[model samples]
Target: MGYFLLSRLLSAAVVVLGVACLVFLLIHFIPGDPVEVILGEGARPADREALRQALGLDRPLLVQLSQFLQGLAQLDLGTSLYSQRPVMELLAERLPATVELALAALLVAILIAFPLGVLAAVRRGTIWDRAASAFALLGVSVPNFWLGPMLILIFSIGLGWFPVSGRAGLSSLVLPALTLGSALAAILSRMVRAALLEVLGEDYIRTAKAKGLSARRVIWWHGLRNALLPLITVLGLQLGALLGGAVITEVVFSWPGIGQLTIESIQRRDYPVVQGCVLLISLTYVAVNTLTDLIYGWADPRVRLGIGE
Candidate 1:
């Protein structure tokens, strides 16, 4: 396990370096003048030159990259051109909101999707199963923008149950969390159902039934336990996607999360902020993926012995 973990860590470092290079090259290739964006109009040539020099834009690309890497070593990303605040500080401020929202959505998805899927699989060919299927279809079909507004209308405007937008307390979190979780739940339900169906047909399940174990215990423990391997994998991938996808829900709800900050910075072509945000999101995605790989071992003991490999 130690060797395995060390290999994973080393590989992750290589991937992070590749990601940094890709983002750096892509951003520089984008057509724009950071100095002009920062200095504003009617500035004299000398002033523009000074600003460019101050921001390190006047340096050669290699020199700039070296300096950036050096700063990265010291955990410095420079201050934002617009906000004049450290990139790390801004990220630290906004990280909690995004973490809270993403975690809420994931919890809701698991709480709802797993049981629905299990029920559908256990009660196959019945109305309950059909209902779960239909729910999945509807979830995959609806656009988040439309769903968000409908939620705002019914829950916030019509029923007076929740706020229309903005994150404040528990009441404010519901609509956005549901808005994000609903679609995820739908997808998860389908995945879970399929996983359960496959696991149910295995020889061990038949033996358990033949052994006269209670149906509930057989399905919930024997069946669900084995079925969870695939669900765990998908959960990691989907959670990563959800982190990026929340940009829309965050914007609509006026939630002060990293996604909103990314959009605003992109519009103004704020390079440092954009880079920091993208890097953070990438780090989150890869970290989740690493966790997923680790989960396979816990979910199934044979995973370490090349059984799942």
Candidate 2:
């Protein structure tokens, strides 16, 4: 366990470093001088030179890249060109909102997917199974951008049940969470149903059923736990992806989360904020992937022994 954990953490560190460097270069190499973007056409030549010198834009590209990397070692993402505030500070303020929305979406996915998956597996060819598949298709086929507004219209405007936008409270979070979770739930249900169907065909399931155990008991107690291995991996990885996906939903609804801030900063070409936000997101994805791999190894003994043993 110790060795595995160490290896995973090391991999995560390398991935984070590579992603940060890539993002830095992407923003750095963008066309049009950043100084021109910062200062309009009316600015004097002397002022432009002074601004370039002050921002260290006068330095060679390699030197600027080196300084940026060194600053990153200490968690300093530099200051935004537009806001003149530390990028890390802005990220700290915005991150919690994204985390909250992602959590809510995960909860929604679990609640909707698990039962439907189970029923589809148990019922097999019945109408209930068909219905589950249909719902899953809708979840996968429809894009969130389109679904988000429709949810708002149906729940907020049509039924007058929830708020259309804003992050004022729980009511406002409902539509956005539902919108984000539905797509995820659809994909997850298909996986769960497939996993469960396979597990049910195994010898242990037949033995349990032959012993006169109730169908629900056999499925929940025996089949479910064994089948959960693949589903667990999907849950771990998809939950991380959902964090990234929430940015769009958050923006559509005017939620003040990291995604919204990241978009706003990008539009203004605020280097510090853009770099900081992208770094945070990339680090999160790598860390979560590493964690999921480690968890899978721990949960399945076959994976821990390196296969040959």
Candidate 3:
């Protein structure tokens, strides 16, 4: 286990380094001058030159890249060009909201998907299975950008059950969470149904039923436990995706999370903040995938042996 963990951590570090270099180059190469954006077009050339020099934008690209990489080595994300605030501090402030939204969304997805999936698998070709399949189809078909507004219209404007936007309290979290979770639930439900159906056909499941165990025990204990291996994988991957996908939902709802911050920084050409946000998101993706690999070892001992290799 220790060896597996070390290997995963080392791989995660490499992925993060690659993401950092890629994001830095991409942001720099994009056709926009942060200095000019900060100082209006009508500003004097002297003012622009001074501002550019102050921000070190006047330096050669290689020099700037070297400095940025050095700052990263020292755990310094640098200051934002527009706000003059430390990029790390800004990210620290915004990260919790994004996390909260993602976790809440995950919880919603599991609650809706799990039972529906199990029931569909148990019922097989019944009406319940068909209905669950249809629901999954609808959930996947509706994109978050459109679903977010529709949710706001129905729940916030029409029903007034929740706030239209902003993260004030639990009530305010509902619509955004729903919008994000709906698609995840759809995907997970299908995975769960497939996994459970396969597990139910195994010899152990039949043995449990023949042993005169109650139907619930045979299904839940013998069936769902084995079926969870694939479900766990899906959950880990989906959680990582939720963080990335939150950007669109956050924008539609004005949620003040890292996703929203990324958009704002891009508009201002705040290179430090944009890089910081992308870097943080990339690290999160790598971290989650590493954790998922660890969970694989826990779920199946055979997987642990594979990891050691």
Tens digit of per-residue lDDT, candidate 2, span 40-159: 778889988998898888989788788899999988899888778888888889988899899999999999998999999989999999999999999999988899999888888899
Residue-wise C-alpha lDDT for candidate 1, range 175-243, written one tens digit per residue: 888888888999999998899999999999999999999999999999998888888898999899888
Global lDDT of each model?
A: 0.86, 0.87, 0.93
TM-score of 3: 0.96
Alpha carbon deviation, residue 243, candidate 1 (Å): 1.1
Q: Which window of ten consecutive residues has the lowest lDDT sum in model 3?
A: 300-309
- Arrange candidates, best lDDT first: 3, 2, 1
The full ranking of all candidates by TM-score, starting with the best, is: 3, 2, 1
lDDT of 3 by residue, 1-309 (tens): 778778888999888888999999999998988888998889999999999989989999889889998999999999999999999999999999999999999999999999999999999999999999999999999999999999999999999999999999999999999999999999999999999999999998989988999999998898998889888788988999999999999999999999999999999999999999999888888888889989988778878678455
Please list the residue runs of candidate 3 whose C-alpha ends up more than 4 Å from where it truly belongs after superposition: 307-309
Cα lDDT, model 1, residue 261: 92
Q: Lowest lDDT 10-mer window, candidate 2?
A: 28-37
Better of 1 and 3 by TM-score: 3
Better of 1 and 2 by lDDT: 2
TM-score, predicted candidate 2 vs. hidden true structure: 0.94
